[model samples]
Target: MSDCDDRALIEAAQKDPLAFGALYERYVDRIYNYIFHRVGNVYDAEDLTSRTFFRALSHLADYQDQGYPFSAWLYRIAHNLVANWHRDRSRRPVIALDEIVARSLSEQHPEVVTEARATMRLLREIIRTLDPVRQELLVLKFAEGLSNAEIGKILGRSEGAIKSLYHRTLLQLREEMEKRERGER
Candidate 1:
């Protein structure tokens, strides 16, 4: 949807809770996928996704455009909730292998699937080792397919900063993967 369409939806939703359902329908999958990646499980993802929408609905009246997409506001809520979830658990993040495998199963042969799964597992492990901000950056940039500008809005960084961080992140991932390969040898 265009920014204008989203803005209209937000305005309508703010005036009527029922209108918020349209906004929810537009964003639920994206938000759920994002939460699912962060929490690594369906149950927690579902819980957090619900919490995100509820919070958004409750605060809809307070929302101001600020020129960013509505998704940015929703993402900020998800990010804060995920942060608290990790802090409360005192554990490193995990990406569920089954979820990854399931998503890829339809398109690849078994052998290719195995290789892809292994690669994704390694990447996820490396990603978990990153600071939360960097991890969030990767998820937003790659997993969610957000543009650098969109990621910057959600991450509270400049678009240039997001570009630079993405470059550095790829370098770090490459270095980490090399270290892992050398150790395996």
Candidate 2:
């Protein structure tokens, strides 16, 4: 559904709780994927996804249309919950590159599959070493496929800031990957 459709659903849901089910159906998978990528475990992702929707449903009355998609609000809620989850556990974020790699790999060649998995594992490790903001940027950009503007809204930054951060993040990832290659040698 388009953002306009989501806005209308939000307005309707604000009036009747049953209407919120449609909104939840529309976004549940995307929100789950976002949370899953951030937390890297199915159980925590499922728990957090439930909490995110529950919070959104409870706060639906206060939702305002600020020209951003309803998903942005949902994402903001998910982001906060994930942050708190990490803070409480004192654990670093772990992007599940295995799923991502598996999806992208062709099963035609055993050697290629092994190489791709190894590369993805290395990338995942490097991503975990990045600070939270950069890791969030990567997840929002690649994992969620959100545009810079949407990410900016979720992160509370300008679009230009998101662009700059994305650029620097790519550079940093490249440098880290290079360092890993050198160390392996």
Candidate 3:
């Protein structure tokens, strides 16, 4: 864990409101990225991102260290908020695969980017098809580049259990990608 612990900051914030801004500044980017990946829209991402911090600030008194970093606790709040958003909407987000493909192609070459974009688009689509828990697990493991142990803290699972789930989730994603390819061919 880094020396700059957010739990301590949160505790301090509970005593003084101004201290909370430090925590917000520290995590705004990460939280925004996390929310953006889940929601796939900058506008909704911004709103949810703000809401995450707002909710966290309100519940700051309830936060406990529990060995995990303060960022993990904040992530839990963001994760729950995303889940609730999905449930309330009752509609899966429509990821803009074309935009991703176009941006990749423009940055590289159509020939070079085409296959990669297709794979990424398929991957994103397949991820959405999985259960919410699986989806969150994959996003945190892959997109956020979190270690299994770190993920365990965020999701409140054993590190070993997280490793197992990570492996299984990767296998499932690979199978889904392969199936998509086979169908295309």
Comparison by TM-score, 2 against 3, better one: 2
lDDT score at residue 146, model 1, on the 0-100 scale: 94
* Candidate 3: residue 8 lDDT (0-100): 68
Model 3 off-target regions past 4 Å? 1-4, 97-107
lDDT of model 1 at position 105:
83
* RMSD (Å) per prediction: 2.0, 1.9, 2.2
Question: Residue 40 in model 3: shift from native, Å?
Answer: 1.2
TM-score of each: 0.92, 0.92, 0.88
For candidate 1, write residues 6-110 as lDDT tens digits: 998988888888999999999999999898888888899999999999999999999999988899999999999999999999998778865657585848787
TM-score of candidate 3 relative to the true fold: 0.88
Clashing pairs in 1: none
* CA lDDT for candidate 3: 0.82
- Encode model 2's per-residue lDDT on 108-184: one tens digit a residue: 58798888899888988988888889988998898789899989988889999999999999999999999998995
Position 178, candidate 3: lDDT: 88
* Poorest lDDT segment (10 consecutive residues) of candidate 1: 97-106
